[model samples]
Target: MPYMGDPTVSIILPTYNRLAYLREAAASVFVQTYDDWEMIIADDGSSEETRAYLRAIADPRVTVLWLSHTGIPSIARNKAIGRARGRYLAFLDSDDQWRPAKLAVQLDALRVSPDCRWSYTAVDLIDADGHPVDRDGLAPWVPYAGDITERLLWIHAHIAIDAVIAERRLVLEAGGFDERQRFGEDYDLYIRLAMRSPVKVVDAPLAVVRAGNGENYSANRIEAYEGWVQLYQKHSATLPGKRLRAIARSRRAENLLILARLYTNAGQSWAALRTLLLGIPGSLLTYPPWAWRAAKEVVRACFKATQRRI
Candidate 1:
């Protein structure tokens, strides 16, 4: 369907060299049940094949912005966002696809809740081969609505970037994605947005996310944990209320403990010890539970080291 006027939603899709997945991702948007939408594909210096594929798109509703390789998704996404011509904005990763009614359902939810400018839906996890996979060890795939600021602050609410449809102005007011953050940038944006307004939810799973892909940054355990710690600390200083600040601190401490364990498993005992020491102050300041958990992890690491020495 050709839309003459400005679209209701502008889908910001950032892509790199994943031409095959990008093809499928774009195709999903083309088949959406809702028609008043435009898709902006931001290319992050992909190979000629991917560029050629993007150029071949005949749909006028779809626009492609070519940019030099920055290797930072936030930069590419922000560029696409700058060119978006819609009241609402949605995101679809190059590796993810959406169900046919995704836009229709999310738009309906937003219409019903006039005050809610942002919405997210549950997502199904799929492997690189497009086969359904179990979400083991991942946060629960559930729908959360209304003021989710506290849940987001505590890292309890999991909102996938691909599963969101937010107002364009709200996204801009939230400062877009934090360009400095390489990992967990989406989480950072969601937290800021939730703090600004109530969120609506589409209870059904509409987005299909590709998990366990080697290209995923979250696969790097140590770096991902470090990114989480940085994210928590960044928000801790700005988020209102002493209780919220404490929650942020405690969450940061948890990530630090996890990072220490990762370092210990990699046989970097000194780094692990340093990480544990760094988390101590925050853990002590917030409450006892996290401090106790930190101490237990320290003892376990020491025990493992002693066994290796013996």
Candidate 2:
């Protein structure tokens, strides 16, 4: 179906070297029940084959921008956002796909809740082969809507990047994606957006996310840790009230425990121990369950002999 008049949503797709999955991602958009949408594919210096694949796309609604290889996805997304001419902006990473009703349902939800400018849906995880991976994909807290900022600060929600759709002004107001962030860019943007306005959720899994692909940015322990630290430092001061601040501290402690696990996985037992120690004190007050689990995991892993771990 051809798009008529102006599009309601501008889909920002930033790609690196993931050519194999790019076509599938675009196909998902083409099948959307909502016809009024534009997809901007930002080619961040992919190979000639990937470039050719993008150039072959004949859809007028799909605009492809070729740029020099900039390792940051936020830069490519920013370029797309600059060129977008839509009331709402949605993100679809190169390696992810969405359900046909994703746009229509989200748009309807936002229409009913006029005050909520942003919304995200649950997600399904797929393996490298595009096969369904029945892991604990969604967050424990589901179907959360209206004023979820406090809940966001404390727990990890299943809001996938491609699953989100937000008003153009709100996204820009949140300063767009942090260009300097090599990781956790989405987390930072969503947190900031929630701080300003209430965000809603679609409740159902409307997105298919590719995880454990080995090529993903989250695989980098050091960069992931840096991103967590950056998040803590950036948002810690803005949290209102002592309770929220304590929750923020617990979140930081949780991140440290994750870092400790990463260290333990890499056979850096002493480093893991040090990281766990740093988090232990705050974990007791903010969230004891995560703290205890982290401690047990870190200790168990620290005892293992040094070996190359994935």
Candidate 3:
């Protein structure tokens, strides 16, 4: 094992079956203007293609490790961190790629602000095909502060793990990533990190996130929001009073609305109706368009129940 004592960063790229995308993502990493870095590609149980592709990379900075299939991203990420040997740990999803300047600029930001333990850059939302996304999905949270501790509780406005770079010690002290969470693990990790210290942001966007895949995690909004609600419940003890209670109420509505859809998907319309009703007021106030849609579903379910009686 070569001691990369002077390397600036270790980027963890986790892949399951994305051989072609992983190849492109790897190329992007090698092309970075900032030369001193290590890229560890943690390959979860993948097809023979990806297993073979991992063997073909020539870069000395790149190291590929294989593990059996595990659906939990947090676990795979934690495994990668265990293998990391950099002063700073950056994350780049297998399907995503970064601009050449990403490491250089983000390092400058982290260097200038010694008090901030973690920093992230903005990112471009692209399609599954790697084409630029027209929709401004993550742009809403732009120009946010270097110190963003309290603001992280409400919602996960930061979507790109590629944008984030955390000090290795800080990443370990923050407990790294949660291994148990099936959904919204990134959100939970960010909240915990923010609570301990400030999360800084670079205004410039340096990475591109693949979007528009119907199978993407965010597609199941209900489960993700429910997980968010649980995250708050689990961590509320460490937070302030009103903020804690309000987050529960706020996240509860989001969870219920998602649960309503989940119930509907499971063909439990009545259960869905109950959840929609319980979730409405809060959702109406917080998630207007989505809550509005849930309200319509509630009315539809009520009429369907009346018809069943007839």
Considering every candidate listed, which one attains the maximal TM-score?
Answer: 1
Residue 118 displacement (Å), model 1: 0.2
Models 1 onward score TM values of 0.91, 0.83, 0.84
RMSD of 1: 2.4
Model 2 lDDT vs. the true structure?
Answer: 0.83
Looking at model 2, the pairs that clash are: none
lDDT, candidate 3, 1-310, per-residue tens: 5544657798898888877778888888988999899888888888998888889877788888888888667878898899888899999988788999999988998888888888888888788877888864434755566445455665545646878888888889879887766677887787767766676688887988888865465676666756765675566555646656566556666667667766666666788887676565555665456666777678766666677678
Q: Write the per-residue lDDT of candidate 1 for residues 187-259, one digit (tens) a residue.
A: 9999899888999988888999998888875788888888898899898898878888888887888788888
Segments of candidate 2 deviating more than 4 angstroms: 1-5, 136-141, 264-310
Number of the top lDDT candidate: 1
Candidate 2 — worst ten consecutive residues by lDDT sum? 301-310
Error of 3 at 164 (Å): 0.4
**Model 3 bad stretches (over 4 Å):** 1-6, 136-139, 270-310
lDDT of 3: 0.76
lDDT of 2 at 235: 71
RMSD of each: 2.4, 4.2, 4.0
lDDT of each: 0.89, 0.83, 0.76
